[model samples]
Target chain A: MLLKKRKSKEDTALFRLEENEGEIVLWSENREVSRQLSMIDLQEEDLLVLQKLRPLVKENIEKIVAQFYKNLEKESSLTKIINDNSSIDRLSQTLTIHIEEMFTGVIDQAFFDKRSKIAQVHLHIGLQPKWYMCAFQDLLLSLISLFDETIENREDYNKAIKATTKILNIEQQLVLDAYQKQHDEIR
Target chain B: MLLKKRKSKEDTALFRLEENEGEIVLWSENREVSRQLSMIDLQEEDLLVLQKLRPLVKENIEKIVAQFYKNLEKESSLTKIINDNSSIDRLSQTLTIHIEEMFTGVIDQAFFDKRSKIAQVHLHIGLQPKWYMCAFQDLLLSLISLFDETIENREDYNKAIKATTKILNIEQQLVLDAYQKQHDEIR
Candidate 1:
């Protein structure tokens, strides 16, 4: 009889975020799973909502980038990644454009295509999924805090968060399925 | 009789992941809220997770940043802001760090401290939340996908997620109460 592989709790990983010039990166160790799931595709209404949020989202991205760099200058590991003033300046400009587009929205093809490319990149790098998720979660809290002042009705904001959480659950299922297949193959 | 000020969803703001350097950044228009939050003081466990995920998240941030720049390189309104490559690079790096930090762990005093800072930053910039919670939800999906790959057990992972979500709900309530107090003060 073939024995099925059992999953252990101790084997679980964590998620996190990272900073590169002006952009925020959600990093993870589970590249194969993330890639297999095709996670970034947005529904029609999701796109519409994102489009509506473009202006504020764009501005928020820029500010988050600026502040993050200012903080990183204080860290040693980051110094190796970011060398000088010129490098920082270029990063900020690139980040502004990036944030603008994220809020603008994307179609399914573009989203999936990007995810595939990202998967390829991760495979090349040999990083794991745990690190990425932890970093990304940190990034989410920062963004939420950034927008805290504008949240006039706490109830509505909470409801929006609930909606967001529902979507995340769906995405998680997709990612798990993808990871399982890959793990089995590796074994 | 005095009339109460009616709050509108239009007054709310949204946040998202923007690309800079080789990473992602959290962006939004609402400066006040962003300034109030901070992503710097992540827990040791969270930081460990983020460290592991850095590579994959960085690549995705770079991809998003590149696409954003490609689009902006054409538009007249954004050209002035993104004219220089150096600035773009700096911005990307900054954003990568911020994004890496955001998703690393559960929200706590450190998270709240960062949010307070972000809120202050937004106030200075004179921006507002635009996208509501859609972009945030997308960011969460990316993290979840990564998590699935690194974690070997489904039951343990689910338990962690449930615990985290409950904590977040509690945090949300505190945030709401604070907002109500602030609103009353403004009134």
Candidate 2:
């Protein structure tokens, strides 16, 4: 029975697409799309909160990104990875875009595709999850500090932090999901 | 400066090997292999604790593995994945071997290789981390229950549980590392 299923799967174009180089068609793309979002408990309200913070994020994004790399560069191994696989300038630009998009308050197909692309790129460069998680943790701290520094209302700041945490969780989930998919294919 | 580093990297065979299909030589392999072990803080004492549990684990692995699949089969989506991509019998056999190996309590290159292979196989089959994590969580609870039932000493049980958690964390780190390496290669 499994053999028959494998045979049918092999005969499909999608399977071939997976077999092709530099092309990824996620299995989830065929299933219920919102399942992952639901898994993270990201909702309309969370998106709204993020959307509300867009202007603030925009105001600090340049400073936030600059500070992110400045801190990242202090690690010697990561510095080599950045220098060899990519540059600080390039990473900073990409991260700026990534941060801006996080606050866009939309979870559409396009958003998933972009997130998947980021995950794929990070994976291709052999970025360990340890470093990735660390990098994001730093980014999160900076963002939270932004909230503390700027947001006047405690309640609103708390809500914003919650929303940001959920969004970041969603992002990490995408990266992990992508990593899992590729990890399977590696063998 | 970054361009010079990139150029030098591209000239290396390791870079070429990375670009080639079905060949993965992780960046970590060249560095201190024990780095990941240190990160998880899996020490000699923890290994000793797990070594002590080997006899009990050997006795109950069959039952634990059986219960694992029985619980996993309750998830309809996972069942479909199993039916389509692999057989319950094969997975059960591999998992039994994996569980047995965990108790052997040796952290060597061979052990790391086996764990990496397991991670790669799961990735190829498109297992989501959510299900992977849930399955392991279930497995961990069963292992804890085993300690509860068999170990008469509370201190012994507590030590065993902590060791088990560390071993599992080490296992997970291997899986995540493999995923990250492959994630980078997917592009």
TM-score computed on alpha carbons, candidate 1: 0.34
> Per-candidate RMSD vs. true structure?
24.3, 19.0
Off by over 4 Å in 2: A1-32, B1-127, B131-175, B178-187
Where does candidate 1 stray beyond 4 Å? A1-44, A70-75, A82-86, A119-131, A159-187, B1-187
Per-residue lDDT tens digits for candidate 2, residues B1-187, read 0011122312433211122222222223524345545434456666766766776787888899988887676567888888888898988888888898787667767777887887787778777665665566567657866765565443454466667766775676667667656645775
RMSD of 2: 19.0
- Candidate 2 TM-score versus the reference: 0.48
Q: In candidate 2 chain A, what residue range of length 10 has the lowest lDDT sum?
A: A1-10
Please report how far candidate 2 places residue B166 from its true position, in Å: 18
**lDDT winner:** 2
lDDT of 1: 0.39
Clash number by candidate, in order = 128, 5
